[model samples]
Target: MKQLFILFLFTSLFTSAQTLETIFIDNFEDGNAYNWESEIGWEVINDNGNYVFQGTGHRWAVSPTQRNSNIVITGKFKIITNVFHLNLLENSGRYFFGIHEGGVYFNNDETQIEDVQKEISLNEWHDFEVFTRNDSLAFSIDNENIISYKNNTGTNINAKLAFECLDDAQIQIDDLIIKREQIVYNQDAKWVKTGGPLGGIGYDVRVDPNDANIIYVTDNWAGIHKSYDGGRTWLQKINGIYSRTGSTNDAIPMFCLTIDPNNSNIIWAGTFGMRGVYRSTYKAELWEFRGNGIPNVENLTFRSFTIEPGNSDVVYLGCEWTLFEDEVPEGANGASRGKIYKTIYGGLNWIEVLDADALVRTIIVDPNNTNIVYAATGIFDRDHIAGSGVFKSTDGGENWIQINNGIKNLTVGDIEMHPSNSNILLAATGRLIGFSREPDSENGEILRTENGGETWNEVPVTFPSPDADDWTLFTYLEWDESDSNIVYCGASDRGFYKSTDGGRSFQPTTYNAPFINAGHIISIATHKEKPNWVIANSYGGGVFVSENGTFSWSDASRGYTG
Candidate 1:
């Protein structure tokens, strides 16, 4: 009887594996559509009938719906484009083969895989396959081994598949084939130093005022890292910083980091995770929540921070307020609905002064007077929304007046005042938003105000039009502290431009910077100790250091991310 039972068990396992066959296939040809519905928690989009495998339903979703075992799925997909918009969650959720796993349907808390695959994009039909054998799982794209998982205890043996297209995307899929398999491939990259540049998304980076060699960088999805040897080697200082939102493989994104120039020991960091802002008096050895005055709600993005040059105690932060669809004023503000706060005594108390129903893009203090300040607000609406223009407050935050008279229909991004001259001000302006489609529309021009922003005029800079390489607007502008008359500007589509006579006339820098062309310059800071030692921050191309006044450049993003 025992021998007979063992034979029956083997037979049952074999039958289960064989029975895992293709039960349904929708080519969209037989006029028969599958019961397709989007998961309520996920965002879904349909391509223009080009991605359909058969008829007209090539569904794709970001942050896929999690599911469980006993499945064999395959599809013939052609990437056609180099865009793969997969937001695969880690540890917090499960991803088997390439399909994510978790949700209530799986009868468990969200379970996620610990590994991620590089974005697969080949403009040809590639066969994708996924299979599971009890506690083990495997996946492949076009027979090219991708990922495999083991020791996973999950239920609800079903999964959801969809397509994704965020920017100028197109794809096609057909001839889906599914079958059980006992073979699995090893497809994991061993953690080898490779002696190459450390790569990851760097959210915020700051140079230690006390020790220029000592640099601190916060990874947007990784934990906080510090380099004592000037970005040579990085050590993770995530003792108190939570990284639960990131993959066990990746780091949580630290949006902003600031160190008190007066006291390098006093450090502050703002995280984009479930945990909010954290402060460490002992240089990030240990940290505690410092988001008391700021909102404690979810998805609160702490963007820009400015410390009073003379008074380190006085700090200002630009934060993105949490806004729900129902909370908006019925098409009044569109996607722009955040606020700016200031704290005179560190984080003890915060005052909300500017509520323009728009994002406080950039904030800067008056170079001559600390009390006088300027804040640039603009609509963050992705589609179609207006900008709040530029606002100035002579009495700190007590009152403000829109100083955007000459600057009509311009969305202000960056504001910089001459270090020595209070009346000389330079602002970086664009159209209503960053992603304007109008080609002929004047995208960006440096506006100058010799009379403290009471009036303004466009500087003579040959801004590239949409026809010329699809270039658009200027991102960052900086005036030299040594010579306030010397200014530098960088654009997203175009490379770099410089102005010798303040904002009167401008010319492109000697360095074309083609490799760094796709990225926009974020901030340009001059070395206080060294003359002509300038550093520029690229949005995605990391950082560049220029020694010859923007005439020559070198890559300085040794430990930086996009």
Candidate 2:
């Protein structure tokens, strides 16, 4: 009897190893029409594209219904060329490797992949392997180790695989394979860096002011990530957060992060989803809930937060609330809402200063007069009916006045003021999506006021007319402290420009500068201790640091996140 049982066990093991399920086999001899179904959800543009099944081109789509836990997904992908674009537009242009398990997709879609290993080649056949055992998952590409994921919730695992395309990219694919297997869990593998500028996605990077080495990054749907040595080593920080709640999505969207400039020990993170702002005081070792005075209305999200420069106890928050026609139920109470709040005593006391049915985009304090403040507001829906335009408050947060006399039909996005000259103000605005910029529109002016907010004039700098679609939607302007007349500005697609005569006339900086084509300078901070040192934040690209003004640049993103 013992001998018979041993033989049976051996047979079972061998059979299991040989008969791993084949998911989808695509030779791509014809076109993607036969083996794959092309479904474009929210892709901006779709052009037919070829994709290698294994070399960062293939993606999975888990069925919307399933309840299994342990799953094994393996395949063989043959790359036909050395270079190929992995277009993920079919799945909202977001996901790469999606696992639909127990009716829950890995990142809310079957298009999401936690990690990918870069090894498969275009001229050869390679093995692709993924295994989910217990509450963990592993991926191997071409027999090489790739990445491992720990499934804390032990959700069901049921998913399918497919290919994605974007911008008419092209490549060849063949010999696909898959299997179900059980394996030991491991957490020692590194993450394969993928996706970026290719998609409109951006990352929020947090730098420890005291130690620039410690950095935290959050991808669109990948959840919170941490890097101890700048961005060299990264780890997923999704312990308390769900990778995928409803669909097969595996991301935690985060917008703004603020580390107490005075105390690097304190950290604040504003995230979308059910959970709002998260606070960590012990250097992010642990986190606690801090969205006390904030609203919990549906779709209301916290976008940005600013700490009082002199007083860490004071904080301001900006939120975006909107009600889309599709978002409303058959019958609802009212349209969506948005508001901006100020907390004089940390988060203990909250006051709503700007309450509108629109989103509060940007807020800034005059460097010369801290009590003076400015805020830009815009409607959130397609109607674009009411916008608060630019608001000014001379007595801190006590009172506010509409400063839109010379501004008309403006939907403001960002606001900036000269460090030395509080009277010099710059604003970025846009027309309704489908409309064109009118000469009379107040949407594209680098407004200047030599005497506070009493009056304004169009800076002589002839900005690309609002009709220039290539210009950045949310443009940024900054005045050089070394020379007040020397100002620097950047747009999303229009590249970077410099003004030596205080926004009167502008010229492109040297092409060699890092600010060129950098896109929306998120924040520009001149090093107080180091006079000529200026740091500029790029949305998709990392940070660019210049020692000799904005003339030359270096990748300061060594410790920063993408």
Per-candidate local distance difference test: 0.56, 0.51
RMSD value for candidate 1? 18.7
Among all windows of 10 consecutive residues in model 1, the one with the lowest summed lDDT is: 99-108
> Could you give candidate 2's per-residue lDDT for residues 457-520 as a string of tens digits?
6555544455553333435566665566777765444455677787776666631444444544
For TM-score, the strongest prediction is 1
Q: Which portions of model 2 show Cα errors greater than 4 Å?
A: 1-200, 203-219, 223-246, 273-275, 283-285, 326-337, 366-371, 379-383, 394-398, 420-424, 431-443, 462-474, 479-486, 501-505, 510-526, 529-562
The regions of model 1 sitting more than 4 angstroms off are 1-205, 209-211, 223-225, 229-239, 243-250, 259-265, 273-275, 280-286, 322-334, 379-385, 431-442, 463-471, 510-518, 560-562
